[model samples]
Target: MSDLGALFYYLGIEVRQGKEALTLDQSTYASKLLEQSSMAECKPCVTPMEERLKLTKASTAAKIDATLYRSIVGGLRYLVHTRPDIAFAVGYVSRFMEDPRENH
Candidate 1:
């Protein structure tokens, strides 16, 4: 293959090359996702989810836009590649994509 150039960014992931080691991150992608979810200014939590918190189908809770929810979930799934810490949360939320509710 032909040499393209120095690796900087690819598929929404940022690449940092150094003499000692290389680093890959999705900070920009994550920030954009936060902006998309309207939580850019939201406070950061120590944990992604509360321990032993159960999530059931919110039959009584108001329903959210399926398209938007799906889009957010999809983005989260993609982000999982660079952020495995959120895989559990993303997978949990993804379960409700078929019919996401406000409580979900």
Candidate 2:
């Protein structure tokens, strides 16, 4: 072990330690996530999803391209490993796996 106070960088997680406390950040990972999701240029919202947003099956749900939806869900799931903050939002959207609506 190095004597540099446990500075660790692994799998996009950066851990820095100091005399007072430890800090965790993933700006790099966040950037990559945005890029992978094709949202790098998208505007930032106060929250990933609106609080009142309620998703439900549409009566006339348009068919979705499963491959695309699954790809998006997979990428979001990876972010959840470290970004628990977005877990709920990601999981909420993923629930559509049974029947994804094109409008979504």
Candidate 3:
């Protein structure tokens, strides 16, 4: 009845078709992003984020590294696009950006 030809590209992602199935991946961009963040040498994990870790509001009296913390969380945000596995962790950390504390 119908045959939709091969897909070339979509939404910044390239499409590759084979006989058996369709596979989705962001390998190229993911590699570049990892390298840019100096995480190339980091250990590879089966999961994108830890389930038990919880981020709480920091304390007011401690000294907070706003720039570094924000940068870390920002990177996480970008990573979330392809790796929604870490979206919760990234979003959790982002909540503290407005008033990051040093102690907590």
Could you report the Cα RMSD, in angstroms, for every candidate shown? 1.2, 3.1, 5.0
Better of 1 and 2 by TM-score: 1
Off by over 4 Å in 2: 1-7, 59-65
Task: State the RMSD for candidate 2.
Answer: 3.1
Give lDDT for model 2.
Answer: 0.78
- The TM-score between candidate 1 and the true structure equals 0.93
Worst 10 residues of 1 by lDDT: 51-60
- Whole-model lDDT per candidate: 0.90, 0.78, 0.70
> Residue 93: error of model 2 in Å?
0.8
Over 4 Å off, model 3: 1-12, 59-82, 97-104
Per-residue accuracy of model 3 over 1-104 as CA lDDT, tens digit each: 88778886665456678899775556675676677666888998877667786667646567567876677677667657667887876787788887777655
> What C-alpha lDDT, on a 0 to 100 scale, does residue 73 get in candidate 3?
71
- Per-residue lDDT over 1-104 for candidate 1, one digit per residue giving the tens place of the 0 to 100 score: 99998999999999999999998999999899999999999998868878887888757789998999999999999999988998999998888999889974
How far is 3's C-alpha from truth in model 3 (Å)? 14
